[model samples]
Target: MTLSPLVFAALIFALVVSISYAVLVRWLPDPGKERLAQLTPGRGSDHSTLWSRLQKRLLAWLLWLSPWTAAMSGGDEETPSALRVRFGHAAWRSPVALQIYFTCKTLLTLVLPLIAWALVEISPWHPQGLQRFLPLLVGAAVGYYLPDWILSILVSRRQRALLHAFPDALDLLRVCVQAGLGLDAAIERVGREIRQARPELSDEFALTGMALRAGSSRAQALRQLSVRIGLKDINALVSMLIQADRFGTSVSESLQVHSDALRTQRRLRAEEAAAKLPVKLLIPLIFCVFPSLLTVLLGPVVVTLARQLIKPVG
Candidate 1:
């Protein structure tokens, strides 16, 4: 029996999906190994899989396709460094990720306009003259900046997560220090303990702990942590810790004070947001709710008046 076109198409799609899934499974790293490597530092090397190598090559080709654009936007010393810093702030530390991001931006910027133009040509409402070019231009502009917008959103979310977890991490650190753990040990313990609750903060702390273990000074590790996080609270905490270490002050006391201050600031922020709720709602209330309400209440009256006037004229 012959299959219908729809059935044939569905079978083809299912085959494609299954093949893709199989390839992904083969190429992906073993999650168990990855987790083990993360938990136990220096035990195993993170070797690149075949899939990762292929992906890197593809991204390189994409970059090579638009050398001028990549050079102008990301290849320069200043631009690459800034992009790396931005990636770190967003918790994405891979340099190759930046290359991939630029590659995607370039492809989108070129491809979207072509796709838009093709769509316009095939559309039933065949646009004429300026309309034909307008969508293409708009699509190109949007595609060019889409990566930047996505990166900004990622950075904001990461920063917000860091902010939300900061006070809790500080409290944990203070407790650990008070219980006689060294600062480095306390950081490691905090990272391990907070892994489930705040993965972002835990990762930062884990990196700082690794730096400390790798023979970096406390001040240097803390400073690098501040740079990676790019948060005022973390910077101030790093400075405070450095000062406390230099002056032979108690680490626990400093941490406790900072944690309390952070909590107060967080509360104030919450209150400020609550206070702005009414103002933010005002626009929706006026434009949406008020219009619907007025239509409902006055619509019948207007209809009745119109009927009465029409009857008199008749």
Candidate 2:
């Protein structure tokens, strides 16, 4: 018997996919050549390699498929500056990383629906037209939004780490300044000393130092730090520093005051979280723990009462 139209279509699709995979595997350069090219230092040597040319062509194809990738990647006037700042806060500083992110989004958006459709088609259940397309829509939507969710998680985690490190960093800076070091020296010293305890904060401080050393004004560097951190507290601190620098105020005294304030704020946050713990636990207790407890406590008693009440009449 001849195959149905749907079956014929599926067989053709599978053949195409198989052929594409075979071609790619056979044509792509070996991993050894790629590594050799990497080891060869000069651009001329690397670019001349077969693997490098293949890699470039592959990258070009991906870029063509996702032409909007570079535009959304970063620094586009149309793209929100806040998003670029968020990427910095998340420690994804490479310009190419944004392109890779958008490329992933594009690939997922295109690929997931096809996969969903193929799976639905091959299943014994044989979903109807609308039902078959439903998974495709869902897959596309999820694929599109997944990157944003992942980025948000990264930003939140980094912000929390920086928050935890800030007060200690402030204390270190204060001590260094009090010992007669200049502001830049105090910052650099704090960065080095706090590296073990708070790597994220140390990195931020180190970057700020680098910017300062590269001849950027202190105010400009501090502003950049605030942008990188994307924190209100850092913004406030940057503003305070700029003001102090303008007026020639004692840096040590300012740091000391800020450090104390941060400590107080941290303490208050801890206390607030502690106070909310019981409330947070209430739902779990009612839904999970209480049911188990009630069953354990009343189960035997209910059983005995049931037996007594159901006694047979003579």
Candidate 3:
């Protein structure tokens, strides 16, 4: 149960950081708290229920460099950055998400090299010349991009889920629209009906419904939905919906057509994946399966030839 000096030192460092955070939160004025309170959305700020929020406020304030860094970079400060949009697509629509991401990226890039260096120092293995800094540099690079990698994974998983669940949503929406429901009502009803079956798409539909209810125009809400989902098929569906809504077209018929198109897209995606199967298996076939097969097939022939040649020589 004994901790190594390295582990002990890490633990002490963490403890000191935590204590510093606690003291800083206790005394220093918090702008993060003020910002959160402004956007509190009518939640009562009772101290008992706000302990977790209180804890995060100071941390967000302490991680203020991210926004400043973004500001220093050249771009429209008003419009959301591409990184922010990616985070939104990943279903992390929180105001503090980008801030937290930047903070983690900065910390990891700075801390991992030091950690690697410490380990190198404590360990018996000594890396000479450029080899000494290689691990540290690699660690720093990995740490810096680690958050991006995670966000990409989350976005990919969420998008895959959305794609698989989308055709179901479309079918339901078409059914609802044909069943004497208005488009908005159809969407809301579809959202409710599909909630149990496909919650990812269900949530998107539900949010779109909410946005419509909250005074956003149909086109705007649908556009936002398409952007957030970031699937070609979904974007197409959004365009179709917007056009249908604008031109006073038959939504039921449009839904039917779009459903067919989306299904075709899904099938094509499946077929494309199937087509690539051999390509994906190529490496394993060559390195693993083919070698074993050659060994089994050629071993006896090679041994027989060797025995004949050796017998003749004797």
Candidate 4:
């Protein structure tokens, strides 16, 4: 019922920070104008509109120091960064937006753990300090990478959704191709048709079409498509397309086969996940569900037995 000193302190700190952030945002420059300044690494503006500038600076500082930010910028040795694939062409054209993202992430990393620690400490079932701190540490780590993890998850889910929709897209493309459209035109038409339902795949296909229109070879466009989407299925599809283009094969037949193969792979993946459910459930059953069941079933017996034994002893 009553808040602890620590909880009160955190609440106060949060309120002050919120108010400060509001005041900062009220009078700031559009980070878009200063985006290059932030990216270029120079003596940045001392002030943007005033409030927004501080927010931007705070964000820049956070981005400058965050583990996630640092990790994002680093290159993978053999495999190119998936982040680059996903976001390489995204218009992160606003410095303020970038800073805001980092700031939010940093606050999540810090505040969630503190709130978690407070909740754990105050709980009637509060475990030992070691046990409690373990959760806090886990919460902190989860919170820190949470955004990137969510982004990765969204990308994964989007890819799955696209894979699911790929058959329809492919069928449409085949129709277009059969109806006298060029390969590129067929892809463009299919991309447009599926834009709403399979934005992830549609966007990549559109971009591929754009690349081809811009005079990139079909192979190059397909390769770029594979790079942008960053999925094994898409990569395989791209390779197939490239090979078909190179060896004078039937694009429609090749696509039809690939679509069927993708659907099969998706089905197999679903089965695999379903098979994993029992293994995943075992831990919770053992650690959580069983204990509660044991308490309910044996608790009264234990109490009665204890009373019987204690009475005889007395």
Q: How many clashing residue pairs, candidate 3?
A: 0
Enumerate residue pairs that collide in model 4.
24-51, 27-51, 28-52, 29-49
For candidate 3, the per-residue lDDT at 99 reads 66
Between candidates 1 and 3, the one scoring higher on TM-score is 1
TM-score of 1: 0.76
Model 2 C-alpha RMSD vs. true structure (Å) is: 9.5
Which candidate leads in TM-score?
1
Please list the residue runs of candidate 1 whose C-alpha ends up more than 4 Å from where it truly belongs after superposition.
Answer: 1-80, 124-132, 312-314
TM-score between model 4 and native: 0.58
Per-model TM against the reference? 0.76, 0.74, 0.71, 0.58
lDDT agreement with native, every candidate: 0.85, 0.83, 0.81, 0.73
Decide which is better by lDDT, 1 or 4: 1
Ranking by lDDT: 1, 2, 3, 4
Report, for all candidates in order, the number of backbone clashes. 0, 0, 0, 4
| Clashing pairs in model 1, backbone N/Cα/C closer than 3 A | none
Worst window of 10 by summed lDDT in candidate 4: 88-97
Report the error of model 3 at residue 182, Å.
1.1
Off by over 4 Å in 3: 1-80, 122-125, 293-314
In model 4, which runs have C-alpha deviations exceeding 4 angstroms? Answer: 1-83, 89-155, 304-314
Which stretch of 10 consecutive residues in model 3 shows the poorest summed lDDT? 67-76
